[model samples]
Target: MEKVLSKKRLQIPQVVAALKHRNFRLFWGGQCISLIGTWMQNVAQSWLVLELTRSAFWLGVVSTFQFLPMTLFSLYAGTLIDRFPKKKMLIFTQAGLMTLAFILAVDTWMHTVKLWHVLILAVLLGVMNTFDMPARQAFMIELVGEADLMNAIVLNSSIFNAARVVGPSVSGLVIAKLGIALCFLINAVSFLPVITGIWLIRLPKPVQPASRRCQEGIWQGIKAGLDFVRKTPGIFVPLALLAVINVFAFNFNVLVPLYAKNVFHAGAKTYGFLMGANGFGAIIGSVILAIRSAHGPKMRSLFIAAAGVSIFELLLVPAKSYTLAYLLLGITGLWVITFTTNCNSLLQVQSPPNMRGRVMSIYTLVFGGLVPLGSFLSGSMAHAWGAPAALGLGALISLAFTVALVIWRPSLLKQEISFKWQD
Candidate 1:
């Protein structure tokens, strides 16, 4: 752990001071608050579904509902992002999420929450994210210019992982005491930081329009993004690995409580502790990346990390003790995020900016689109082969992906990432 912290060799921008941008600082602070709330809602919402029905199938169904909007709206949303001001679009998203959080809180507090409400809110949130994810991603470069691209990416991961740490543990306490509604309320409060940040940002004037190209139509843009991916097997190859991990290891968000109840015979607090451990590891990984992420000579360490995740995923499956499970889950979070954040940085550096919006939309597509499938498969797999076996298979697939990527993009291993400033 200490060595990982010290191994800072990746070429960060000389302008390590991008965080000094008043607007970027505001954005970062607000996003950190808001993302923590998002994680809280995720944990609370899943637990609420299980509480209402105690059925994993219902759990899978609700998860599916949440992600359906992303599948339906993502491509068009990316096109809209290209055409509009991302700052204004994100303000809308943040405000809308706050509204959804308030409704969820009220429903839970009143004890009137039902499975349908969960599904409704989940889908609505997904719809909001369809626009939100793309806009926010494109917005990152604008925040600090291309000079701070790596910093912004690492910092983004930091905000998310930080919230992951605080949100779940706190939500556990909130859910156990005031009920899940409190978790929702806390999440609503979380959005305030981001809203304030957005209000504070002084964006550069919008770029002059490129006359709409032949690919300006929404479906046409979608096709273009797809074509780009098909031709650049390099991008898709690494991307597919992340997608599989999300379905199997990343989707573990929906499975922790199941693990708590069935495997460890623990309650909400215990489950919260498990989540916090994972978050802790995730934060550490993000910080390490932020500090010394490689500019070139892509590390062979990613392959090793992929293999470690499989082992950790397997270790958590049948563990009888919470202590043992926490250790495994922490390791699981660390390696998986390390692998993912590194891949995103590499892909971002390698991709052309003209097509960045579309390339990123494809990133969102696989990232979110695969979840519903994973949620269903994981739930069903847990139902049949047992939780441990299902997760083990996922780990195995991840290992296979790592091996294939190394073989296919051996040049990826030789190329060093370099940062260039944009006017």
Candidate 2:
């Protein structure tokens, strides 16, 4: 175990090799721009939905709409990734996303936007993301080659967290002045960098198979992904942890508006500030991971991070006052980013290039798709128990999940979670 773990550790620095490549920079830059915008829209969309509906139930519902498609659509998207140029696919998705954002802005600006309109846009966005996410996940290799894949993943997290910091702060300011419509418009603009990045970067051809293999369709890919997960508990365990934790504790996004409106008595700007503060913690967490001295692929770091998520979630539940809740949530966001980023890093590390897209699609499905159902349960439970009790219960569930991971995956605890080709 130690020898295998040691070998895996050494692979960590190999991903840093991406910085040496110029094309990778273009791709990274574009991703950073788009991600920031995506975060901006995220903050804006949640609040807007809350404002329009003023119902926490629907907030969970809208969140569900966005992710449910990924659960349903990701397998097919992964299959398509095997069939198409990832870069071109991303371009189409990005363009579709930007156009949708613009249409939302136009609708809102014209005072024609309704709750149903938002739901429609949200669902369409999910469709765009289903294709965009897996392709983007796979395309990172073309930018930097495989040696620096780990670094690219880490750096991507850094950019994402950095955007989390920037997007909400700016979006909050914009929302205070302009409203959610303008925030959507800004999000549309963010897509430009990614589009440009696609236009500029040189990509390597995918290792072609002699023949296409498709014994089934979306369910087939989904079953394949689940089968992969079942065989690799190192991967599936964390995924189950994510799903269980999210069902109880991850409703913070759904709850944020309540925290702001009912608890804090604040408006759009305050909501943005709350999100931005959380982003600060996320930024700090990502930077720590990016610069962690742990040599090799230190994915055991994720187990630690998952533990942090469990702890911080408990912190948020009994928060006596609104300020206390805000602080706990900000810290929770930090831990949240830490765990997910590490999970992604580990998933990418252990997966083979041939099955990478499908594996990651499964990862995405577990991470995001499962969450909507979780949110619904959390919201319903909260609706019954009151907010704090619901949140506390959720936190406890997450903690239990992390504890199970530590017990079941002793290999992960040792930071030895890799599967190499036995040549």
Clashes of 1: 5
Model 2 agreement with the true structure over 190-232: per-residue lDDT tens digits: 8898899888877655466425544456567667766877897
Candidates' C-alpha lDDT: 0.75, 0.75
Off by over 4 Å in 2: 1-17, 209-223, 320-323, 408-411, 418-423
TM-score of each: 0.91, 0.89
lDDT of 1 by residue, 234-318 (tens): 5666677777677776767667777877777777777787888888888887767666643421445455677678778877766
The residue ranges of model 1 lying beyond 4 angstroms of the native Cα positions read 1-16, 210-215, 294-302, 407-412, 418-423
Residue 98: error of model 2 in Å? 0.4
The TM-score of predicted model 1 comes to 0.91
Question: Per-residue error at 324 for model 2, in Å?
Answer: 3.8
